[model samples]
Target: MRDAIKQLAESRSECTTRQTWYSALFSYNYPNSSETLRTVLDLLITARNEKTTQLQDTGLDPAVRARLQDEVSPLIHAHLPDPIVSEKGAIGIKAESVYQFYECDAGRAAVVFVSEILTAVTTELTHTGSIGYPLTTVLASAVGVHSRFLQASKKQVLDDLPI
Candidate 1:
């Protein structure tokens, strides 16, 4: 039992561990990371399912699959309301606060601000300790990947419809 719990905590060699992530997010006791990490896990499982179902034609190689699972496929929340997908008010507020706090509006110095955020988030969320490890990883990179996946899933479902 102890070994299993330890493995579970530190597993997901690709993604960051829950203990580290949760502690970074709030603290070891905060519950939000439970959902966040599980969501990431579920997304990975769904990506595997995609290979068997909608994305079979693409035939991703092992490297691509590992990259997608480990780096690019985690969902992200946009600072502005993402009405097209789903509305997460709390995340939206948090994102907005981050953007303003860092002054993403600070055009010339935006690089520093963005870099700081990317470093913090990546350190906490990815096992690689670097952005998109193997390629070019960033906090927002997963959003692009997952958005495309959602779009592909929609297309696949529509194609199956008789209409």
Candidate 2:
């Protein structure tokens, strides 16, 4: 029993093990895991980097250019709301002082901004692919890769578990 507990503890430290447990316990996986979020973000980043680099090339193809312009650029450049500093009274007086709320968690702010952009992309893809057909294709492929990674992770966790 002690050995079993120790083994379980050791396995829990593995990321795949934790992902499986999170999926089982929460009935959802990505939202609850920063690692999973990072995985998705990594896909976005890689696509952005590769395409942006290609865009910089002087001999870019017209079709690729259209795709990048219509699809990728808009998503990357999606506007997010500026942090509110304070609320003012009708008489133009400061209603109350605002703390350094926006300044406190810059990382969280970035994550929230990214999450909103991802949400917009997903929503647009689901509805009309209005972003662009090319972007939709790229997004679909990225999602396929991410799904495979998660499936492999879960399988690895199961394989590693004690019999």
Best by TM-score: 2
Model 1: how far residue 14 lies from native, Å: 15
lDDT of each: 0.31, 0.34
Count clashing residue pairs per candidate: 2, 0
TM-scores for all candidates? 0.18, 0.30
Clash number for candidate 1: 2
Q: Compared with the true structure, what per-residue lDDT tens digits does model 2 show for residues 90-127?
A: 00001122101111122233333333244445545657
Cα displacement (Å) at residue 107, model 1:
41
Off by over 4 Å in 2: 1-29, 77-163
**Model 2 TM-score relative to the real fold:** 0.30
Model 2 has how many clashing residue pairs?
0
Cα lDDT tens digits, model 1, 1-163, are: 2122223333333355344332112112211222332343345435444644533447777776665544323322221111111111001012222211111111222233233345445546566455446444545575455444433222111111010
